[model samples]
Target: MSAHDFNPLLDIPVFPASGFAPLADRLKRIFATGNDLLFIQAEALLALEAAASSLGRPGLVAVNVVTSPYGTYFGAWLRRAGADVVDVVAPSGQPVATEAVAQAIEMLGHVDLVAIVHAEAANGALNPLEEVAALARAAGALLVVDAVASAGGHAVDIEGLGIDIAVLGPQKALGGPVGLSLVTVSDRAWAAMQSVPRFSPSLLSLLDIKEAWLDRGRGALPGTPPPLEFHALAAAVDRLEAEGLAARITRHQRAAKASRAGLRALGVEPWVADDDRASALVTAAPVPDGVDASALIDAAAAFGVALGRGFGDIEHRLVRLDHTGGRAAFGPVLANVTAYGAALAALGQVVDIGAGAAAVTAVYGEA
Candidate 1:
């Protein structure tokens, strides 16, 4: 433990910074787009706020889709920046419909931007991003999507889908660290960002990052980079590619389907009724009427299953079953649901112990 006492991690250099740009290039390939991808040093939410704060302009009109707390904050950030925002909010446990977006655009006649979250892990809902992106394209509006939870689990083609800015986080679906946020920018998005005036030299300035990448040539980052997160991200990208994106997404899809079938057998209602509208990463279900959510979660933990805590108003009535990245495998799926079923039985609920696990195995064993 001494200064020069053969530290194993000492060989891992965090400073010379030679590996930064090539990693960014690899990320662009993973995204399946030929756009500029910036690796910001923080979580995905900060990356999202940076996008809104940088792109939001005065006298601009936007159609903001609100399905969760993040959507609500996105709208507020834009409004605070002097943008005329039109919010298209959906009910709890459901995604915003494409028809709703079209109607809003029709009513507004013109819009400068359209912001939406690709999936809501908060309530297990997946938005119709392609259809919403189409509406934004038709109205000549820039589209920004919070694809943090959907990046590895779902298909996100930023350029092909007409998205101006698509934000990504490696922590959730990619099975990477939570300290880094990657944003992919289209050429059109660059134009919109530059044409506007700057509020100040904001740390979240996409323009500055763009300058560092494009103008200063390749292999250059604007400031001191977070090396640990960068290296971890690289490792995750390698693992994902080896498994193949299609296979990873299919695994997530199977996991979600299995959880839905299994949770239904347990008498708990899925927060999102339609499987098509649910996120592949999370399966949200209400805790049985008489069971205390905290106690149930504690019970699951006692059996070695860590359940995600629910958020917002439904925190007490709901529980989140996360099956993402490493947990999307058959083993983790069975463990999580089985733990829940056992916890329910302990709480005096009439639950089928073997049935919940059988549903998961049946769906996963299909291969």
Candidate 2:
């Protein structure tokens, strides 16, 4: 079946009230098998709060801010916690280099923590996590990764990669509800939190949640949780594991290849030129000359394919084609490509629809 052929409902199974036990059991097993860490929200603000309290020396904390658009918020939070922030700025269109991160740590002289976003879906960039992790470890800095866009969409071995804390949300590649997030905290991270001063909102406190889960058990909690979203995330995790993470990554890679090929055939080029630096989840392309991206978005929606708009500073000149979620299916992909080609045509720009479809068909056929 094509990627778009599966029923959305088939992607997540409903768990009855009595089924919570088995579901929780499954989560426990999954965590234990992987890195034996606690799950938390994808928001780095929350993770930093927990990390600050866990590390004790808030003054010694140094955040390695990269090219992520969300770095704006993360930087604010780090400074609020009294961290000495260092912005290792990469160009908006590309990933930050590990050498830059290492240099930042060296300049700081006493680095306590290093935070990096794996894939900034907001801007269509994928950072090199393995290289960053090595630099952080060599510099004796605790590593925290925001893998919200990269988690299931690409390969990430939290423990093997030497990441102290890795955060993920279910919304992007997992094809689940958004509110539920996961954080894999290594023993090193747990120890850091153990030493930190405790100061945070009750609901946002990682210590409180970690203690409850590690001490009492998985089902135990300080207050009511987002049970439905958690259940949905668990179902998403199951689907990912069953399908095989490697295979899922390969599928996304193929889809991205097909999409880029189609766009090229239509005489449009990606905003981010380096193929290796671009993310598989989303591609940012310049709006064809004489075509208004906003108008194209409206026209594509008429065809039932929703494309993400360029965010932040890149808003007007670019349009983001998101291949994440259930829409990664072949049919949805073709629909999006065809609709986009047609939208460009409506704007008086010439495009070869046959060639675009054929490019996608070629990739899908090979897989």
Candidate 3:
């Protein structure tokens, strides 16, 4: 279909006011208005470059690795960017230990950047960034965070977290269309990026994007920006700001609590052992005995509730419930629970439908 013929949601908007301007403004407002924050389309790739540049091309970079699909991709990107990576591994269903990060940095002795994911929706794991940031600072490494899944789902204070670069995507919890991404760069990160050689192509170059954002006043990049994605993102941001970040976070937290409670009542346990490491956006739970997760997900699809199967290695063993974004409400939570229960029942798995619905209702609490 032609761009014009496509639905309003599919149309791309112009930059500055329609595209870059609102994004730039929202980012600036969040990450300290006076600080230099570069707007970029290719956020993940640019973030990798930013991290490499910040470390002064140190021989080794330390990454606090968790069982996340993004970690694998980010590590590959770092290696391609010419940084030797030392991964501090955390097992599946757990957050990376702060001590592991500290030890790795200490052993490396002059690590460049410490890269971490704030929340990994793939495995429903959330890292402890506050402590990790402190560890990075102590080791004299710039802290880069992948906040794509957690940015709008939970509260993120880039400056307060001591993050040098915070990367986010509009797709996940932001309730916006995909393709468009964002990255917030601190002054230090911008300076570091400026000094690094442009190893990336024009679209992926952090330095070029930064220069464009500064020189072009939001319409710096060549070609037109994605208008509908921009408008959707702006509307998402407006809704988030109006609802208040704290309130939105609380809503997600409540949904998560309800989901977990319902799952437990159904004789299912969280895939992640530690409650502290659980993310509000997605919850990974073990499939019941004799139940095939793929079959379960397929069954769910028939009921108009498309549940996500386990990603990567965990496929077939886990089922993931995405409770964040526009789904963070009492009604949606109840609907998801009822639909899931029905799916299980259809699959010959005995589930207490009333129990699951009651758990959600209890969380909503007469609201």
The candidate that wins on lDDT is 1
* Poorest stretch of ten by lDDT in candidate 1: 8-17
lDDT values for all models: 0.86, 0.71, 0.72
Residue-level lDDT of model 2, residues 186-242, one tens digit each, is: 777777766655665455556777776656655544454556676777778788778
For every candidate in turn, the CA RMSD to the true structure comes to: 1.7, 5.7, 3.1
Give the CA lDDT, 0 to 100, for residue 9 in model 3: 51
> Which residue ranges in model 3 land beyond 4 Å of their true spot?
1-19, 31-34, 42-60, 216-220, 348-350
Ranking the candidates on TM-score from highest down gives 1, 3, 2
Per residue, candidate 3 scores C-alpha lDDT tens digits across 318-363 of 7778887888777777767777778888989888989888887887
Prediction 1 TM-score vs. true: 0.95
lDDT, candidate 2, at 334: 80
Best by TM-score: 1
Clashes (backbone N, CA, C under 3 Å), per candidate, total 0, 6, 4
Q: State TM-scores per candidate.
A: 0.95, 0.86, 0.88
Q: Write the per-residue lDDT of candidate 1 for residues 1-367, one digit (tens) a residue.
A: 6677876355555733567777778878777788888888899999998898888888889999998889999999888878999999897657999999999999999899999999888878999998998889899999999999999899988878988899999998888989998898888889888866685567777887777666676565666776677778889988988988888888888889998888877766688888888999999877878889999999999999988777776778778898998989888888888888888888899888688888877887786
Q: Comparing candidate 2 with candidate 3, which one achieves the higher lDDT?
A: 3
